[model samples]
Target: MQGYSAASLKPIFDTHIKNDAQVLADGWCGYNPLKEECPNLKQTLSNKGKNFKMLHIQIRDFKNWLRGVHSYCNKEYLQKYIDEYFFRFNRRNHRKINFR
Candidate 1:
């Protein structure tokens, strides 16, 4: 995160987000080239009024879930854990239809 090189961020941003998706970020140099990388990217900067409130809440909830359920997850397995969390969260409302 300290370096703004595309090589360093490709794995996190390029791989996870689609080229047409808009990106929201703080006024950080790392995100400055988002529009350049993805021509359709609508980059937004939050100068005030809790720009990252939803993201912050999700991270906080994820941390709490990990701490409460797993006690302490290792860094190596954190991404997989996060992926599973997203999977379950995304399908939460489908459980009723799925079982019946």
Candidate 2:
């Protein structure tokens, strides 16, 4: 986002996250406003990423994939690249299943 402010995050949360979905985030002030919009929002200290080990790993892997595979990305298409990566990542275990 342009900045980690509530205004910057609101649109993303509204577009991508369901209101009823449980959301976990670091105890950042930017996420405070989101609690009103998302009833299930939870905030806690990150403990230097230890509290979110798997999430950190996934982020690291995505960065590595971006650097290794694309080398560079256009700012305009960065979101599309992230979406594609997570689409595959989310379905990695279900590859044997047919979509149709």
Predicted structure with the largest lDDT when compared to the true one: 2
Worst 10 residues of 1 by lDDT: 40-49
TM-score of 1: 0.69
Q: Check candidate 1 and list the clashing pairs.
A: none
Q: Write the per-residue lDDT of candidate 1 for residues 1-100, one digit (tens) a residue.
A: 5576666777787679888776665666665566677776554566453777788788888888888888988999988999988987789899997778
Q: What residue runs in model 2 are displaced by over 4 Å at the alpha carbon?
A: 72-77, 98-100
**TM value for model 2:** 0.73
Quote the lDDT for 60 in model 1: 88
Model 1 regions lying over 4 Å from their true place: 1-4, 11-16, 39-49
Best by TM-score: 2
- Tens digits of lDDT, candidate 2, 1-100: 6877999999999999999999999999989888998989999899999999999999999999999989999999999999989988889888779464
TM-scores, each model vs. reference: 0.69, 0.73
Instruction: Give all candidate RMSDs, comma-separated.
Output: 3.3, 2.7
Q: How many steric clashes between backbone atoms does each model show?
A: 0, 0
